[model samples]
Target: MQRKIRFNKAPLLGDDLIYVEQAIKSGLTFGDGTLTREVESILQDQFDDAAGILLTSSCTHALEIIAILLDLNKDDEIIVPSFTFCSTASAFMMQGAKIIFADSEIPTMNIDPQSIENLITPNTKAIVVVHYGGLGCKMEKIMNIAKENNLIVIEDNAHGFFGSMNQKQLGSFGDFSTLSFHGTKNISCGEGGALIVNNDRFLDRARVVREKGTNRFNFKSGKIKKYEWIDLGSSYLMSEISAGILKKQLLNSNKIQMGRKIIWMRYLNALSEWAEENDITLPSKPHNYTHAYHAFHMIFPSFETTKSFLKYMEDLGIEAISHYVPLHNAPIVLQTEKRTKELNLCPNSSIYSDRLVRLPLYYGLELSSVDYVIEKVLSFVVEKQKSKF
Candidate 1:
């Protein structure tokens, strides 16, 4: 009998269980407990000694906090990659933003800086970029674009945690960054995230925004007599239970990160030849990048080949799946967004989104299992030639 391989497994390779038990016993399972602050501190130190860090319920919520902080409205436009999770655009949309979707770079599938520059207008207030698959985007270019236009840069860094470009951390480049501790992420706490505020001016407001429009953080720091609702916000706080788990995950980062890196390299090394012969494109390993080792994906020659390859993996009891569909092409966006004036704004986004497939990658995934997956992946045939979606 063959063993089943999962696309991703929620990690438990450390003392997270112990911390969870302690948090429950302490009767402080609410958000902002001691354990939660510790997680925030860990992230702050690791991500460029960030000025303000707030643990949130999810990366999506963290983005929402920034959206509220910016006071976005219909008069303001925000540029985001079409190839990203919906929250990247929807968060700002909830704040009445005009979502301007941009194309992706072929090298890394991150938002293309040129596309971003072209999309910017007088009304463009922010540029949101996702570091797809833990690989850093062209942040230097993106940051320069933002600087030139005086637009805020928000990094939806759910996939890039410790990953870096030019030896600086991925989540540290933007004016504001958000991290995901989703079960599928490299360092997970079942369901948690953090907001990393790099700009000093927004540091105070970010805390209030995360605390449901209240100045509670000020009150806690003895800067105020009482906390009250002062701005647009929500209960975007992460629970102590999740933070307890996250604390241990952070503490065990060395072992976990190393293990995942080894596995990711195994796939890269073994699949190189097979991928070349099959006309499949592996994830880019640029000289300047330290990958977060989030997920290993392949870009097949065509959507048909991608579909067939996924089914082949499924038949072998090895789970593989496709990633985000182009956000501009998503049903909700197509139905609600008014983009008749500028058609096919993100062509590259549609091309890659339809032709990509992601394999399993997680901490403690056995080398032998990884080898088996490599072998099975090598056996798939790519009869279909590259074609339009």
Candidate 2:
């Protein structure tokens, strides 16, 4: 019997056992342990120009801290792509800021720089850019707009660890960048995240915020006699056990990345012609951008066609699924006055929500498994065409 291929799978080596055993022996199972420090150090080293790095419980928490550091007011507005996870906009919304949903470029599924500039107003405080599927956004254009407007740039790089554009890393482009290490992500520690502060001024505040408003981090470093609450914050730190697992994953990142890339390329090569002949659209790779192969998605002709294809694939024991719904249209958006029609955001996002399907591509997934998935998908397309007769 063969194992069924999953849409996304985590690569956890036996090294996690060693780390857990070491953490148990050290007796520092909480957040402020050597393992946590090591994980932060690894992040700093990888993101070289970062002023500092703070580990958080999840990317959502990292985004929340960024909201605090931004000091958003009730009247402030933050522009975001509509085709993203809720955390991208919810973080700012939580700070009482208005969310201005921006349209995404059809080809890359990233925030359109032109639309971003058009949406800027006197009350605009920041622009949140999500590097969708580990593909870098149009940073140069977006950064130039932000600089001209004197607005902060926050990067939602949850899917883009180790992804780069024009030789510069993705996380370094903005004032702050957030990463996720959830089980479903390219990297995993069960549930963890990190904040990369590019500007030195935000580092101290970020540290205090992550440490539950205490100066404990400074106190532990001998910079202060004792730690105490100095500002509004929360407990966003990751446990030592989680950090220990992440350390091992970081060490083996190259192997994991390589395997994922091979799988991604295999799918592209195998399905290119079929995709073209069927009038389906594959993902676009922008110039100067290197993707981490976080996901492999394609657009079908229509929502009905996509649904039909998914059912056909499922019948064949191949589980292909769709990506996010347009957040601007989600019910949660109605709670706030930020109406979906106001921004004229991404008509394409609605199209993607209805028509796109994501296929499986995980590290350590066997070549035979890849072929099986492709075969099933191609067969579905052929059978669906025949059934239309």
Candidate 3:
């Protein structure tokens, strides 16, 4: 029997062990320690326009920090792509904001600027954009809309860390951006994230929120005599061990990204002709944008076809899978009367949610395994087509 290829495995990049050991020996294993500060500094140096960087326990927490910094009020509305992870909207929801779901553009599967504009109302406070599969969203148009409406922009940069559009990094484009270092992401620290603040105005308040509503950061820097509860906040800091691992991953990001890029391109090359012939859709890259090659996905013509393909791959010991369920229509999203009445209103979100399939594209995935997956998928497509005839 052939060995099963898992969907994703946490990458074991060089220096992970070394740095982790160094962090342990340093004896500061808690939050806001040496490794955490080093990670933030490294990120600030790499990404242009970074006003400040705070390491967080997860990307979800990073987003929650943004919500706190914004001081969202009850019933304040936020526009978000319905195709995104639940955390994208949930962060704002936790702050008593109403989530208005927006549709995703077919090309990049990022939030549609037009849909965002349509969803906006006087109550709208912010527009949250997710950069799907490491490809940048239409930032120029989105930013323009945000500016005209005087609404803040937050980037759900979980998939696009270190990726860029038009020579500018994805996370730097928005007022605030969140990065994930979850095991499945391009880089892994098991569970870690960063909040990148582009505007300097929020730097002080952001620190307060990140340090549990206290003046701890100022106190530590000797700007203040001691720490005190100063504002609304949470325990959102990343552990020193996680930060140490992430530091190593951040330093080696380029190499890891290059490896994933090679795999992504190979999949595109192998499947493009087959996909076009079958009326299937492959991932699209817009001009002036560089993807981190975080994930490779295909959209089948129908839900049943996609289901069959996933099942076929599983039978062959390859773990192909689907991405997000349409968050707007999710059971959790619809449970409340107010939420249910709001309606998802995103037909395209449902379209892709049912038909898109994600292939395994991770750091340690072997070429042989990739080839096996490609062969199996192509075979499934061919057989399905023949049966149609």
TM-score, cand. 1 = 0.95
Query: By how many angstroms RMSD does model 3 differ from the true structure?
Result: 1.6
Candidate 2 per-residue lDDT, tens place, 1-389, comes to 54456787789666566786789899889896898888889888889899989889999999999999988899999999999999999989998999988888876788989889899999999999998888899999999999999999999999888899998999999999999999998889899999999999999999999999999989999999989999989999999889888889988899999998998888888898999999888877766788968888888988888988888776666668898888877788866664555554568787777888889877788889999998877776788668789
- Worst lDDT window (10 residues) for model 2? 337-346
Q: Regarding lDDT, does 2 or 3 come out ahead?
A: 3
- TM-scores for all candidates: the values are 0.95, 0.96, 0.97
Index of the highest-lDDT prediction: 3
Lowest lDDT 10-residue stretch of candidate 1: 380-389
Q: What's the residue-level lDDT of 273 in candidate 2?
A: 93
lDDT of 3 by residue, 109-227 (tens): 88999999998899999999999999999999999999999999999999997788898988888899999999999988999899999989999999999888999998989998979
* lDDT per residue (tens digit) for residues 28-57 in model 1: 888887888888788777975678898999
**lDDT of model 3, residue 344:** 48
In model 1, how large is the Cα lDDT of residue 150? 98
Candidate 2 residue runs with Cα over 4 Å from true position: 1-3, 338-345
